[model samples]
Target: MRRVLTALLLTSLLPLIAQAQSYSHTPPGHTGLGGMIGNPSGLSLKVYGTDPASFTAYDFLLAYDLDRFFFFSLHGLYERPLPDSPLNYFLGPGALLGVREGSSHANEMVLGLSANLGINFFTERFEVFLQVTPRLHLIPETEGDIGGGIGLRYYFGSQ
Candidate 1:
């Protein structure tokens, strides 16, 4: 009787185990649209990373800065996830472009190099993330700044 009951229980659990094995990670070929509020706060978008080709993901941010000027950044990130966890961390190189609030001889348009570092938590079709950006101003001036923000994204499409 015990052996028969054990066999039946195991058989019944097989489908659940199969479903768990078929789980997909966040993003990963999916696109996420979201917003962030920080130093330069506005729109955010991401082309989540894929596997077997490259571990790189593309992220974009378009926002207005504390100076009331429009700012945009793009990062090509290398992402990794914690073992058996829903948390992911990414780091990568980025480019920054911004327009000055007013026309000036110096840096009417600013260009720079920035680094993107962040952690993400995912649920069903949503992701919550936090990032810190360290930047180097290379055009119009030589300066450095650090910025960070927290954001939520909703992923769509097949992953």
Candidate 2:
């Protein structure tokens, strides 16, 4: 009698274990905060005769991938993303309010608006993404620019 009862209990538990393992393979809704390090490209003045120059800008972003197709990111970016594909992919519209200090420019507050788009890849807990943002600066000078970078994000939630 003892052996029969033990065997029945083991058989009942096996199905529950199998179901849990199957669910583990699917990804859950994830969001994260991360930082990125990349050079800023597409810094150009719109004036016909103005000379073109470039700056190395860094950015820190807070991102929420609402779903696979829709995402929202708030960036503390120094510059903007460029408009192009393949090489300069990931462009979206965004805004920035920060201070700038360069070799020739004084320490001043900057207000900028930008647009961007990008791609994202994810595992259960790790996420990698790349994006580009085209921006227009309102302070110091009114100009058009582009910036692109890659980032890594770690998800936090029930896995």
Candidate 3:
């Protein structure tokens, strides 16, 4: 079931991810601030290892949902542009910590690992991306989940 859903999602995004041409541009800035709306959705912060033409970055996300549970995740990502276009793809491993309400009015700490796969289309001042993440919960119990979303980010200071 999970695999089917993931395949369906990637299929839907493939058309969008593949359309880019005629440009040779590097990523524009050192940091980006954005919001993602998805299975775990909220504020997103992206910071690069190098200011101008970074090939690596860190992604931080904080979200609240599932009847008010809080979630946090951090990803160390390797990002690279596609030779002559502003479109980039990234993949990485990440860790997640979440607080959720359990049965009997108790709260549980959820720990998980996630694999991120995504593509970004960069303009002069902003980036639009589509991402898919597969997550494995290892604490409280073992479970699996599929997560992703379409997001937009605005660069800071310089373009």
lDDT (tens digit, per residue) of candidate 1 on 1-159: 533653575466445444442222564678989987666678999886767477567899998867656779999988777677656788999999997665553446789999999877666666667789998978778989888777777888865
**Model 3 RMSD in angstroms:** 4.7
In model 1, the runs with Cα more than 4 Å from the true position are 1-24, 102-107
Better of 2 and 3 by lDDT: 3
**Candidate 1 backbone clash number:** 0
Which of the predicted structures, 1 or 2, would earn the higher TM-score when compared with the native? 1
Candidate 2 clashes: the total is 18
Candidate 3: stretches off by over 4 Å: 1-29, 51-55, 65-68, 83-85
- Residues 48-102, candidate 2: write the lDDT tens digits: 1112242212234432221111122233322222333212222334576655564
Q: Where in model 2 is the C-alpha error above 4 Å?
A: 1-30, 40-92, 102-105
**lDDT leaderboard ranking:** 1, 3, 2
- What overall lDDT goes with each candidate model? 0.76, 0.43, 0.75
**Candidate 3 clashing pairs, residues 3+ apart or interchain:** none
TM-score of 1: 0.76
lDDT string, candidate 3, 45-82, tens digits:
88877653544888888877445568899898888777
